[model samples]
Target: MSSSLSTVLLIARREYLERVRTKGFLIATLLIPAVMGALTWGSATLASRAKTTSHVAVVASDTVFAHDLKQQLGSSAQDAMQVDLVEPTTASRARLDEQLQDKHSTLAGYLWVTSPATAGALPHFTYKARSAGDISTKTALEDAISAVLLRERLSERGLSHAEIDQLTEKVTVDTSASGNTKAAFIAAYTMFFLMYMVIMLYAMNTARSIIEEKTSRVFEVMLATIKPEQMLAGKILGVGGVGLTQVGIWMGAAYAYSTFGIMASGGHVLIGLTQVLYFIAYFLFAFFLYSSIAAALGAMTNSEQELQQLNMFLVMPLAFCMVMVFAIIREPNSRLAEIVSLIPFCSPLLMNFRLSLTQVPAWQVGLSFVLMTLTIAVILWISARIYRVGILMYGKKPSLPEILRWLKYS
Candidate 1:
């Protein structure tokens, strides 16, 4: 490489090592994964609990209905739930309501079955819970009640208990996707989210670092050795290296988990060698695209607060990508997905989403990378022009017209 390029890389290395050694960087790098892992583990544990200690009351006009509801509720809860069957008298209903309103109420919730006016009409359910946020508990109650009603209906039709059970048996939904759908979904969703977060994270970090140097007058000294474009390149590359390092650590952790059998069988299907390669390619182009814009904006700003006011321009695209996530997952090969995958701002995530959820054609994948790279190049040129003039600027932030004039002058 040329000495100039080597100098740029040297600056990049210095920036990378400097940030990587900081207490804030170390804490964030380690904390993000640790928190994510804890949340994942906690969610799984809560979902897998065999029995919940909920105290639920079931009330119905018919003793049989109340008893059946109670039985179903007990069976469905992961924990040994305390379910009480009560006759639906006005006094009994009022008593339950009072208990629920009590400050020291031990009752979790109550399921009230409104008896149909006629045998032809179906019953209505009114569930009151102390906490409305327990979706799993509510889902379990709904499923249990539905199961009980189905059994009752079948029994009324003269079907035996065996017949009811056999008819109600759950069916497995197999997919043609290369791996287990759950594992694939988890992997795909995680990768897309990580890509978006990493892009925004490093881009913002570049902006903050640039503003820091600009405010502290360090750029005055650095400019003597390097051009504004080189400084921008070095900062982008240096900060980009930190992001890559974090991703590498996470990837290594995933590999270790898979190797030790911590993950389920076919976990490798989610992150094959092909996916990793695509990831690296997309990450590099995405980084350059956003980081270039951040560097230019940072060059113009004198304070971090000033930079924040201009974040909407950068944030909108990321938000748009998030909104497109469901569509890409649902129909990876749809016309909309294909069109979106070619869009420079959305392609990195949408294209990766397609690759993770479904098999994207090699041609489409290559086209996405090509389109994004071209877009990145264009952005870098525009940002470089802006940076060339903007770096020496200080005090008041420039307006849109002033920035446009700077672009022309540069």
Candidate 2:
């Protein structure tokens, strides 16, 4: 191998090893999956416990109406509600309220129904609950009352029970035809954020690492043997490799969780070989692009504090992508989404998001990769010029004009 190629590889190996061996790396790799698992398990457990039957009372002046509403509520599987028929009287309401206030009482709440005083007028409903924000229970009550009212109206018109049942039957939509948009949404949302996080983190780490070495004058020694371009190449490779390794471990853990039914049960769209490959590809594109910029910044800045001030400019593009997330997910194939996904700065995240939710055209995908490659090449070239001159210079931070001149001098 050429000495330069060997030198770059050697530096890369050193960079990779130095980070991979750190306790922070190990903790970070393990902590994310552990936290995710805990959250998943906790959510499932809470949902299961929430299914405990809600005991409530339906109060109406008419005994038959109250009974019918209670019966309708009982038929709903999701609500898991047990209802009581209470006469609509001042004393009865007071008793129900007292029961709700009693900690040991099973009565969660009560629904009051008032029949209209005139013909063709709507009935009034007032729900009093221990928790005013129990929207699910309130929604279930509304549905049950609406169904019962419909039945009553149909009965008054002299329709038979069988005919009324046929007319009022509920219709369910089959989402299987659309490949479960919800699952696609979850997968897309999860993977997009994951890409954003790792790319931002590791890319910034590259800059910080460079600044640390530069500040300590380690570059002065390394420069004697290694070219700045080689050093920059090595740092990007090594830091990116560490990031990829951590991501690989995360993907593996996700696959295991999915496979064993610990998460993403019932054919969830979480993990696949195609998605993995896409993730790795986009990750590299984003990492190399941003890390190149970070290295340039690091070489120019003298202190971490200065890096922090300038870093917001770097973060703005990613932040913009994040702001567009809901819009892209809502319509992955929209003109806006398509246009933004093609921009090299936005492509890595938006493209992956689009891919997860829908089938992107192969040409668009190929074109994005091509554009990103060209952009990375240009950025690396520019950053190398800046880095070559900036790495050795230590003093006040350079102005934009000085930085521009560094490019010419290099």
Candidate 3:
């Protein structure tokens, strides 16, 4: 092997080992998944234990209307609600109000209905709950009362029970038939955000690593033996490998957990083999692309503060991509999604997100990869020129004009 290639590999190996052997690396690798699992379990547990059962009383002037409304609420309750009929009397209402104020009372609230005295006149409804924020319960009550009123009107018109039942039956759309299942959405959202987070984190770490080495003057000594381009190449490879390794470990654990029926039984989408492969491919493309920019930013800045100030430039594109994520996921084949997914800066995330929701055209996918590769090559070339000069500079950040001149230094 050529001495330059050997030097690059050696530096890469050194960079990889230095990070992987750190206590922080080990702790972070294990702790992130543990924290994520704890959060998932905690959220699921809280949702399962949330107070879904709503206890309420129905009061109306008409006894038959009251009974029908009670029956409607009961049929749609799904065992998560209780309904009771109360006479529409001043005394009864005062007693119900007392129940609502009682801290130990399970009564969520009461619904009061005033049936119109004349035909074609509108009925009035007043729902009083202890908490005004219980929108779900309020919406349920509204729907049930409307159905009851509709049924009563139909009955008055002499419609049979069967006809009323047929008319009022709810129709549900099958999202799975259109390939828009909840599981798929959850999977796409999870994977897209996961990629966003991991890429940003590792790319920033690369920048921070460069800043540390540059500050400590480690590069001045290494420069005697390794070229700037080789050093930059080595750092990207090493840090990226570390990121890939951690991701692989997490994916492996996820796959194993899915096999045990715990995650699978919950109806959560499992990361299939194809998804995993695509994830790795996109991660590499994304990490290298962002890390190249990060490396350039690190080399140009003299201090961590300077790097922080300039960091927004690197973050803005990713943030824009994140803003477009919902739109892309909702309509993967839309013209906007299609166009954005092909932009080199956005492709790594947008394209992968598109893949998760729907099958992207092979040409678009191929073109995206091609564009990203070319962009990476261009950025790496620019970063190498900057790194060659900026690695040894100190005490001040370079201006844009100075940076352009650095690029011209060959």
Number of the top-ranking candidate, with lDDT as the measure: 2
Question: What ranking emerges by lDDT with the best candidate at the front?
Answer: 2, 3, 1
Off by over 4 Å in 2: 39-52, 259-268
| Model 2 pairs whose backbones collide | none
Instruction: Give each model's clash number.
Output: 5, 0, 0
Candidate order by decreasing TM-score: 2, 3, 1
- What is the C-alpha lDDT profile of model 3 across 19-133, one tens digit per residue? 9999998997888777656655665576565544688998988888888877777656332468889989999999999999999998999999887788788788899999999
Mark the regions of model 3 whose C-alpha exceeds 4 Å error after superposition.
Answer: 2-6, 21-28, 31-52, 77-79, 178-180, 253-270
Q: What lDDT does each candidate get?
A: 0.80, 0.85, 0.83
Better of 1 and 2 by lDDT: 2
Model 1 TM-score, all chains together? 0.80
Measured over all alpha carbons after superposition, the RMSD of each candidate to the real structure, in angstroms, is 4.0, 2.2, 2.9
TM-score of each: 0.80, 0.93, 0.89
Over 277-379, each residue of candidate 1 has an lDDT whose tens digit, in order, gives 6777788788889898898888888888888899877899989989888887888899989998889888878888788787788899888888888888988
